[model samples]
Target: MPGIGPLLGAEFLAATSGDMSLFGSADRLATYAGPAPTPHDSGRVSGNLHRPTRYHRGLQRVFYMSAMSSIHFCPESRRFYQRKRSEGKRHTQAVLALARRRVNVLWALLRDGRRFEPAQPATGTA
Candidate 1:
């Protein structure tokens, strides 16, 4: 809710219909939303992951757009994205990774009926 504004919030609500039960887990929701790449297994050749053909395009767009916006509006999200970028991930790849991560956070928030809060930075003692 903090990073997501009215339009994106409405899109998310419409896409999910405000129903978290439909997805038993955040991974399921991410898969449905088209962010989690599906694995393809065929005999000896395995470990091939690709975007699912059968997925909610609108839902995917909602997550991508919201993740992009969150980079500026949410410090934690921005840091995550930057970390991904620093790891040699391209722009789109980083955004997609962030979007996938958001799916987990959003799922937990919806399940527990809690609001979004920026994660506090960890403090290290010398």
Candidate 2:
């Protein structure tokens, strides 16, 4: 919820109605949001990733925007984006990857009935 404003939060709720169980898994949720690239294998071209024609574009927009917003305000998320950029990923590609990753984290948080908490940096080895 770090980047999810009232509009994004309401959109997410309207899209899922807080029913995390209905999707069965985070991967499924990502696909529903149109980010989980589907395999487009043909001949020698194998494991090619492409978006499905039938997907909720609005929901996808919500996640994409949330990820973009987080990049500015969340340190961990900004670090993750920077890592992706350093690894040669383009802006859209990096943001979509982050959004997909967020799907898994949000799923687990909801499943565990927990709120989002910023990770504390390690002070030293115990």
Candidate 3:
């Protein structure tokens, strides 16, 4: 929600048909949005993953753009992106991971009927 603007929000609603019940879960929504990679394993080639082909590109674009924008405006998003980079993921991969995470967040918000709230930093008392 932090990165979602009016246009992105509209696009997301359009892509998802404004029915969270259709998705049932965040994983299903991510799969539809193309951020959840699928296994491409062969006989001896396990552990390989690839982007799904039969997904909604518009939805994917909405998530990707929102995730990219969030990196600049959201501290939580920036830290997640930075951590992914530190783990040796490329920019696109890191962004995709962030997008997947955001899908979960969005799904939970919709399911719970609540607005987004940034986490408060923990304080240490002497």
Which lDDT values do the candidates have, in the order given? 0.86, 0.89, 0.92
Query: Can you tell me which runs of candidate 3 are displaced by over 4 Å?
Result: 35-50
**Which residue runs does candidate 2 get wrong by more than 4 Å?**
39-41, 44-50, 124-126
Deviation from native of the Cα of residue 80 in model 3, angstroms: 0.6
Instruction: Report how far off residue 17 is in candidate 3 (Å).
Output: 1.1
**Candidate 1 overall Cα lDDT vs. reference?**
0.86
lDDT of each residue in 32-119, candidate 1, tens digit only = 8885676888999899888768899998998899899989888888889999999999999999998888888888888898987666
Residue range with the least summed lDDT across 10 consecutive positions in model 1: 1-10
lDDT of 3 by residue, 9-114 (tens): 9999999889989988998998888756669899998999887579999999999999999999999999999999999999998999999999999999999999
The best candidate in terms of lDDT: 3
TM-score of each: 0.82, 0.87, 0.88
What local lDDT does model 1 show for residue 121?
78
Please give the lDDT score at residue 113 for candidate 1: 87
Position 75, candidate 2: lDDT? 92
Model 1 TM: 0.82
State the lDDT of candidate 2 residue by residue for 76-113, as single tens digits. Answer: 99999999999999999999988988888888888898
Candidate 3 weakest ten by summed lDDT: 29-38
* Candidate ranking (TM-score, best to worst): 3, 2, 1
Q: How many backbone overlaps does candidate 1 show?
A: 0
